[model samples]
Target: MSKTRQHCFDFGVPPALTLLLGLWGITRNNSMWRDEAATWEAAHRTIPEIWSLLGRIDMVHGLYYLFMHGVFTVFGDRLYCLRLPSLLAMACATALLTLLGSRLVDASTGLATGLAFALLPAVQQYAQEGRPYALVTACEVLACWLLVTAVDASNWCHWAAYGTTVLVAALLNWFSLLILFAHAATIALARTPRAVIARWALSASCAVLGSLPLVMASQAQSGQVSWIPPVGLGTTLNLLMTVVMGALGAYLARTRLASGSVRVSLSALALPLLALPPLLLLAVSLTRPLYQTRYVLFSQIGLALLIGAACHALASRFRRQPRRSIVLAAAVALVALLPIEVPLRSAGSRVDDVLSTADNVAAVRKPGDAVLYIPAARRDTALVSPGAFTGTRDLALIENPRQSNTLQGVEGTPEYIRKAMLTARRIIVVTDDNTSPPASARDRTKEQVLRSHFIRRYETRERGRKIVVYVRRADDRAATPTSRCPCFVRKGSTPTPPGVVPTEQSKSNRTQ
Candidate 1:
């Protein structure tokens, strides 16, 4: 390590930029997406309920739910309140990246690394989300910092801290433990004293032991990740891009730096951290579909460090011949990416704008309205913003999700739902845009009952969800009060309920 003075400017600028960039549109009141809505539903519940819910689903996010539960208790369930932890964690990760880069190379390299991390699109995206990925990323960087310190000082306390952070990171998101494999690879490639190696081994063993319960429990809840598809060409391309960036960075830094040892050490440290976890995931996913970009978001830190090193190296190589031009070019490149960042900061970036769907439905809703979620999993919309569906009866719901200690609560059986559907004249159906007729017998029954009996009235489509209004056909309407909904149309200055469209200058209006 270089014995250089820590410049205040270098130390202060990265985190400040990170915070400003992070808070740019952090307060936007976009309706929470499915995963975030899941967090909101899980965290707002009582501790016992959260625990019980974890037993059945999302055990991997148990610690995060507990943490957010405390945060909600203190801050309330506002948009900023839910996402602030992620913003702060991202800022912290940026700062730690600066420190890690500075330790591995120089102050300038560290500063550049921090700026690169702050500017990363992935970093910006996760920073605004209300999830464990950002927190786990921060913890991963902090653990790496502890590892560097322990290796340098051979201190027992530093190793213990590293072990504790490792366990905490894994508990936050069990997949974050993959960073340990990268760290182990880094240690194996670097030269270290036997005593330091033993202490490092001990710390890693402790982390594994401490994380075992979460590992086991999350495995039991593995169905939560059933959506992740098997690895294919696209997956390979993504991992390759990550590795290529890291390799380019290492090559640039090595060519520019004077010390071979520092160049070799940084390459060993960064390359594995950048490449190993995702590739390992790809290999494992061939049998057990467990690959997701966010699962190894910590890899971005490694890539950022490499980019920073490369930027610093370029500037260093040209320092004697007007370095200002190099800095200007780097600034311009980062500034150009802001256009891409703008959309990412908005609700429109998401597949489902839940708030927009709610607003559209609210506009068309009327008294005596009933609501149903197609395939049932889409019920989070109502839970996310219950006020939007205040007057509407949830046709399939047998209990409130929170009270039932479930993601979106249990639904009535097919026969029960079919009976409930018949009683309501106006029904609003919520469904995923990609949903097809259900394949299971019970789900098929629900689908058949709706399509065969009701006439489609109005349809509103959003990015990832669709809301359809249905009315019983005129032939199916009976004299019973439950058979017809009140109408908005006025016939010859006298209001009449739907299913009784009067003749002679009939008014056409939407029935609620």
Candidate 2:
């Protein structure tokens, strides 16, 4: 092919491939995981409620939740509808990555990078998630592209576009702001013109200033991430391996004919964008636990670009036998990526696998039975179909989650929970498999009350959750015999719905 034709081919094919790859299993009806469940809960609320929620927690995600609110408004709550934004955003990111790589190196390298990005397990994983990370990656990649254009042209219009995108990325996820520091490395490494440097600085300053309110709010709500563990040796080693491999891949992508500035800028970018966030997060985590792999997911973009460049360089080495060599190289890469792609397409791939959990619950639950979530967060298992638990009670529930405008609704106090538990003939307890025995005071009390009064009937364990049933002892009659919980009703409503409460017919269906 002629040079012009090759460049056009490189520009067009990768994005189309990325879109096809991203949409393949995008609608796999996997149960919404905990975080996505949280998104569902928040997005379903009124605008005032969502704004009020950000004042207390998840301020970083407020914009994303609002965006989803608009989506859910038009699309309803279908699984595919919720995930479509991510699918589209990931495709956009893949295209932007191609453009960014081409700007840094050449069109062929850009195409290779886009293909590599589409195949990355992490990218595939988030592309299907109903959360903000995929959007964050898209905006960050776009911001990088704009930054390069702004620097090259030293134009206020391009700088403004870059700055605006930076703010949007930061608002979508505060962790995305870390990219500015990586961009700073690019600026310094290339010794960009003084006018370009001033333009870059102004754009960055605008981004930071515009995003300041959200940053402060998120800081105050930092405890939401307290579950993240302090950095240690194992984590340090893992990050080191990721950084070293990424740098090596980028180094190999370098060609003898590429511009000096492009090579230097690519080197500066691939390393820090892949390495700096985790290291800075690790350092901060030494004082406060804030490090998590998902927060730095955008880093994978840099790694993928480098690896793609390397692929292009390798294919170019056989210049005398180009067509066959490139085909073989592409085939080998696809074969290598198959293992990672397979699981990502399945419902069982997620940690919580809420669909399986719900199916298990539906199979075992009897009428007149009660359900309890060990840590309360496990209530996500029921969120998708509140009606699935119809004819039964949630013993510890204080308010219906949607009614209360909370993630999974509130749990009653331990004393109230124990009292609530005593009324039911059978109870189902959902617990996290990753946690050990005696998870919380509520969990410990539930275990103690059940063991002391009932017998364990059956247990089922899953990848990320466990479910166990307990039946009331035959001799026990001291406890009250209420057939339904009062808590599931909307506030101020008087009577209970019939099928939703336990009945003889419901009990007969269970016995049979």
Per-residue lDDT of model 2, residues 1-512, tens digit only = 89888766777766776677778787654456778778877887888989877776678899999999999898787778778899899889988898887778776677777777877788888988999999999998898788777777777999999999989989998888888888888888777887788888989999999999988878887778877778888988988998888877866765522453443456666677888777888888889888877788898888887777777778778685443454466567767988888778776577775655665666566667799988888897677555456667899999877556566777888899889888988888887876567756877888889877876655667657777766687644543223321223122222233222322222221100
Q: List the residue pairs that clash in candidate 1.
A: none
lDDT (0-100) at residue 100 of candidate 2? 81
Model 1: per-residue Cα lDDT over 1-512, one tens digit each: 23333466677778888888888888544656778878887898889999999988889899999999999898887888888999999999988988888888777777888888888899999999889999999999999888877888888899999999999999998788888899888888877777877998999999999999889978877777887777889779978987997898888888644353342266777789899988888889989988888999998888887888788788777675322433465578668997888888876576675655666567667767898887677887776666677668988889877667789788888898889988888788888777565745556766777777876666666657777767776544543232343423211123333433323321121111
lDDT of each model, Cα atoms only? 0.78, 0.76
TM-scores of the candidates are 0.89, 0.87
How far residue 310's Cα lies from its native spot in candidate 2, in Å, is 2.1
RMSD of each: 6.8, 7.0
By how many angstroms RMSD does model 2 differ from the true structure?
7.0
- After superposition, the stretches of candidate 2 with alpha carbons farther than 4 Å from their true spots are 1-8, 257-264, 320-327, 475-512
For model 1, the stretches where C-alpha displacement exceeds 4 angstroms are 1-6, 255-264, 321-327, 475-512
